[model samples]
Target: MPEIRFRPKYISFDCYGTLIHFQMREAVEPFLIGRLSPDELDRFIAVFRTYRFDEILEYAPYDQVLESSYRRTCRRFGLDAEAAAIEAITTAVLNWGPHPDVPGPLAKMAEHFPLVILSNSDDRHLAASVPRLGAPFHAVFSAEQAGAYKPRLQAFEYMFNALDAAPEDFLHISSHQRYDIIPAYDLGIRNKVYLDRGYDPELPPYEYFSARTLADVNTALGI
Candidate 1:
């Protein structure tokens, strides 16, 4: 848990899955229908997620990463990857809104600390999703601007450079430890909050406070 009186100069967030409802699974589900049984489908989705993370290890356009990962997963299952479906998935991603619990507490936090976003998606997708969070951001950084993604040091490095701030100066909030907390911790961001969306386990070694909603994060920050 965070220190009782702790407050950061800036509160940074991992946009997708943490704030915005990540609907990648929903977007990809239609394409996989009829191709595999229920059990196989679950395994396929898990592998597809791994492939997407692997594809982002090197800098590339987000759409290209999605396309290549989707193709790889389809081919592994002996199914064809449809070009049109990739476009459809990208469109679906751009249209995703915040999770149900986001707006109120996030808005409250915005009133106290300057809020920022460090997201994996590009500027265009963020342009659509950020507004739906019902709070104004101090700044927003995207993988496209950084030329890198989370779990990679370059992405967080870009944010630090852009803000002209050190990691200790900020409090980071994210749901996925693998994508956000782990990398942020490595970069020396000590004040962290893991909003438990259940994508990953709460890792105590990383030294982050765990909460199930933004409301809990708001309370932790004393906002």
Candidate 2:
């Protein structure tokens, strides 16, 4: 067991990338086939990612956010955005399962503390994703309920209000610095874990620990 700053009331998480196998690239790649040259594919996907981030800045259904972003990105490259393509992306999200390293460590932690998720997901999509995670969660919150997404203070505020717990009561984990940890830090959640999945850069000033996987987090928590 390694030293940790605090023992939390709940082990909270940003589900999609931290635990769930987020396969956005895999899901959207087929749609771009022949529409973009091989070199253009990466650039287009990057733009799509940016639009996705932008879409989540304000309140909207996750499906609508996806649709808006997808359409905008497609239009930027002169490709026709189809309704079926939007549906395909939203449907693909439900099929994502946990990362291979998640379940055992999560189960171990669940013995000592309740597990919670504050995901940028629709309620129905969250329902589909949670059961596939193999470990039980004490609570799962969605953007649909909160009217906001990760990195937005409103989302965290809604989650905090719903859990009836203050920022100090939980240890939040995420792979995304911008989308989860950074906002969490700004909101005064000091006990956080940077699940270093390489999706984002690590900023030490935030004062959170780093873990390669949930297993590392389990060890850090002295489980």
Candidate 3:
């Protein structure tokens, strides 16, 4: 076993990009078909992600966030946004499985620590995704439960309150700087792990251990 540096009271995670294969760009690309060049589609995906993040600044359903962001992206690119496309996007999320690296190592961690999830997702969608993770979670929290999304202090606050725990009691792991890691650090969660999924930049000021995969995190924890 590796040296155990920290043993948290609970191990919390950001579900989407960290554990689950967040395939937003993959899911939306087909909709862009002939409307955008390859380079423009990449920009379109980035802008759509921005809109989704912006939409969640305040309380709203994840569906609304997706719909509004998708429409805004299409409108920005002068393309037509259709209801079917919105429906397809939402459906795709329901069917997404965990990243190939998640299950085995997550299960190993779960053996020694209570695992939890604080996701920027709806209960229905989260429900569909959790069982696919191949591990038992102590608690699974969603934006629907918190009435807020990641990067928002309210979401983290809600998780802290629900667990009746303080920020110091948990090890929060995530791939997103703006969405999960930064807010967590600001909220005084000293122990954080950045699962570098390549979607966001790494900022060392936050003082987090970086891992390329869940197995790396498990090894770091001495599991």
Candidate 4:
């Protein structure tokens, strides 16, 4: 385990994969069932995940991201893509519950340091998810408000400006390196925690603390 000291005004999180399971794969599994074999479905899911990441990097709206990623993944899999399927996946994201370990540790940590969420979700969508976190947030920001998505420097700047804090004032925590850590590091956020959920292989060159669960995060903070 990596040793880390938590000393920040706010501990910011990437909500989807870090705090919540981010059921994108689960949401689409039923639709893909019987349409493709298990092995084929795995490949399709992988491609869809990559396409979704690529779409967000272009600074498009989240809805376009879901639609294009669905179409591209369908093309890759030789399946027909429909707009309703994309809409269903997007709706599923908003309906996702927090990870089983999230609510308790998050509530405990909130008592020590203010908690903040920087999610790639719209205001209306996040309205449903944030309360399920079971902790009062100091702030919750989204790509819809920022006009850009994660891995973009502009999104981080929006959060920093909104909170009136410097990069050093936050201990940024996230599960995805490409989506969160690399950009955050480049933007001068040094105290970062990689909440490793196996979204991608760990790249130690980023020099971030790693935790397997939110309980691990609380322990790392000495709480």
How close is each model in CA RMSD to the real structure? 1.1, 1.4, 1.4, 1.3
lDDT of 1 by residue, 35-103 (tens): 789898998899999999999999888888999999999888888888888899878988889999999
Q: What is the lDDT of residue 44 in candidate 1?
A: 89
| Model 3 regions more than 4 Å off | 1-4
Clashing pairs in 4: none
When sorted by lDDT, best at the front, the candidate numbers are 3, 1, 2, 4
What is candidate 3's TM-score against the reference?
0.97
By summed lDDT, the worst window of 10 consecutive residues in model 1 runs over 1-10
Worst 10 residues of 3 by lDDT: 1-10
User: What residue runs in model 2 are displaced by over 4 Å at the alpha carbon?
Assistant: none
Error of 4 at 34 (Å): 2.0
* Alpha carbon deviation, residue 123, candidate 3 (Å): 0.5
lDDT of 4 by residue, 125-146 (tens): 6798899989999999999999
- In the range 18-111, model 3's lDDT, one tens digit per residue, is 8999999888998887889999998999999999989999878888889999999999999999888999998899999999999999889899
Q: What is the C-alpha lDDT of each candidate?
A: 0.90, 0.89, 0.92, 0.88
